[model samples]
Target chain A: MNIAVLGAGNIAWHLSKALIHAGHPVKQIWNRTSEKAVALALEIGADSISTLNQIDTDIDLIIIAVSDEAIESVAKDLQLLPHQLLVHTSGSTALDVLLTYTQKAGVIYPLQTFSKAVQVDFSQIPIGIEAFDEGSTQALFNLAKTLSTKTYYINSQQRLVLHAAAVFACNFTNHFYSIAQELIQQSGLDFNLIRPLIQETAAKVQQVLPQEAQTGPAKRNDQLTIQKHLDLLKTNPAWKLLYEQISQDIVKMYSKDTSSLK
Target chain B: MNIAVLGAGNIAWHLSKALIHAGHPVKQIWNRTSEKAVALALEIGADSISTLNQIDTDIDLIIIAVSDEAIESVAKDLQLLPHQLLVHTSGSTALDVLLTYTQKAGVIYPLQTFSKAVQVDFSQIPIGIEAFDEGSTQALFNLAKTLSTKTYYINSQQRLVLHAAAVFACNFTNHFYSIAQELIQQSGLDFNLIRPLIQETAAKVQQVLPQEAQTGPAKRNDQLTIQKHLDLLKTNPAWKLLYEQISQDIVKMYSKDTSSLK
Candidate 1:
């Protein structure tokens, strides 16, 4: 299927490249800045369109892989082909927002955080897709299948929930690393020392349920160590708040189980 | 070298199994509980000793792979040869703590989290070692080198600092997952949806530094989305605190560069 990408951000740049590599023709590429669109198109040997009005209605799909706030406006500007499927690559935005403009509207969200500097292996990334009509849904499903082994026909509600989970799993988790880096720097240790532990912790969850895999002061209910960590974080409000919130949640999780065992 | 293991916890169990697999001579294994000691020894096909008095002082090393609080007590109980190396597999405890009891003292900390159910590949894990004397240090380093491809000559101060970082990287990061799991549960989404995101976030760090590879609303400083996420966590005070703290940190980190550019 020929695909037209409607943005020039990280997700768009990576996804367009992956599609081209997977033997799909990118019909057209467009960005608010025409140069970005031209650069990406030239790299992938696809046509570049400077304006949404220039987007061909004959294309199979128009993927608006822009920021959450930018998607609605882009959709409003694009004159959709009578039967062309329109989609966005946002995790938080609802599908109904696209449905209002086109009967052949859907979502083609790739469930991985992407960056242009680091190439993503789309074959391993899960793709969440939804469409208002069966024909459009099947097209999106097949398109996802070509690029990945896992594809889900998730609805708008589930997509938003998945998006929220993505925030915790990816965004919030990165914040934890940043905080860890900050704390380790303050403690006068090389960040390299914790690299193995970080890699192993993430690797462990592949084989174990996260709840069963938890190990630490909070998991052990060791209030002494918890207090020590909190004391260490006192000077930095970010670390202090994070330490408290996670500790409290851990306490609540364990307390529920502790009472049941009694 | 004849080795004696003085604990039956996660680290002790895994390290002992690796030693036995590598054809090292484990003289005996001891634990507070006779059953745990017997079980561990049997698992590695070594003898189990219920009393520290029964340990062979002629052994080359006696590793106190116990909890931080129990290390001193265990070290006090062990009677060893004058030249025998005494070490503890702890990141927080100082080597001096063991040096006070034995002339030959050192540390042999494997920088990975271990679980009894999972068989860890020691060859891939990094081992941190330190000793009081050059001879003892070389001996421990040789022993560590035999078990793992990666080894570090880390001092007491470095070990403690590394341990604190491990808490932030592994312990606190897992708490982030717990928070995500809770959010997904509330939103009525399958917790598994976030697994790919979690895995990719960690995998990306291997290719680039954390500072250079950060993303999300917080990193981008997109106030609109940050406001949305904070609002989502408003009901959960603990999560709210964490959200605000991390957001502030992100703001502070980016503000520096943003201001410089202005």
Candidate 2:
């Protein structure tokens, strides 16, 4: 299949390589910065286009792997033939956003964090596909299947929820790690001490429900230990509040008490 | 080394098995519940003592692996020889608590979440050792080295901070998974969708600083998507507040403005 990748960011760099490795040739690559576009295109053996007008109309699929805010603007610049499919790789933007540019619109959101420095196994990552019509859906699904074994047909609304859940699962989880790092650093202990615990905590969730995997003072409702931890955070009022509120939330969750602490 | 394991809880169950695997002969096993003690003792080929008075004076070390609240009471019950070492497996409790019972007292706190259902590789788990003197410290260090490759001489104050950090890295991180599960379930999507993301988030922390690993709307400061998520969570006021506060905190963190939001 002939494909053209939009943007030269982390996702684009990874996606282009995965697509080319999956036997789909990326015909053209474009980015706001011509240098990045040229570099990525050279790396992927694709033509570097300085402007959207130079995008190959003969391409079978065009994937806009740009940021959420840039999706609509990128979509507006596309000039696709009736046979070509256009899709944006975003979890938050609705299908209608792409519909404004062309009737043959779809989504191919890769449900994993990507970094230029990190090489991820595309086969293990889940790819979410959404389209306005059956034909585009099938094409996107087949395209996604080439890059990943785990593919789901998620609609815009479900994708939105998944994105939000990712914030809690990925973003918030990483924030907790940052908080742990800060606390450990302040205490003059190596942060590496908690690495095993972090890995096991995540591994436990794979086999059991997060509620079942839950352990610690909050889940056990050990008020004395909780109080001690809160006391330790007295110098940092924001951390103290966060620790108290999250602890209270966990206690409330396990105790099945609906009483609002606020 | 001759060792006695006190408490047949999850930690004790795993610790005792690991000790036996490391060629340390467990002299006795005791729990408040005789049945559990007997069960564990029989499994590990050790004698089960029904009373604290039955604790063998010939044992080289006695490890109290009970709850934090019961540690002091358990210490008070132990009939140890002057030459024997005593240690409690607790992170938050101060060394002075054990000092009240015996000058030979120390800590052998294992800094990993344990479960009876899941078998963990003890070699990967970090064991924090703290004692009143060099002899006991070296003794505990040698004992810990048998069960785990990762061992540290963390003082009581450092251990307390590590305990608080564990709350953030393990306990609070699990709570975030729970929150993500609840949100996804409410949206009529399978919670499994976020499992891969959770695993990757934890894996990323092993290589990079958590602050460097941070991603998503909060880190990007994408207010539009943030507002959309906040709107979606409006029905659950607690979750809405959590989403708002954490998002604000992430923005504050990367923005480098030290002004507290609260």
- Per lDDT, the best of the predicted structures is 2
Off by over 4 Å in 1: A183-189, A231-235, B185-188, B260-262
Candidate 2 lDDT, A95-205, residue by residue in tens: 999887788999999989887877888888888899999999998998899898899989899899889888888898899899899999888888899999999999999
Model 1 Cα lDDT, one tens digit per residue, A97-153: 887789899989898888888877888888888988899888889889989998877
**For model 1, what is the alpha-carbon lDDT of residue A90?**
82
Best by DockQ: 2
- In candidate 2, the residue pairs with backbone N, CA or C atoms under 3 Å apart (3 or more residues apart, or in different chains) clash, namely none
The residue-by-residue lDDT of candidate 2 on B84-148, one tens digit each, is: 89898998999999888799989999999988888899999999999998999988988899889
Off by over 4 Å in 2: A257-262, B257-262
Cα error, candidate 1, residue B227 (Å)? 3.0
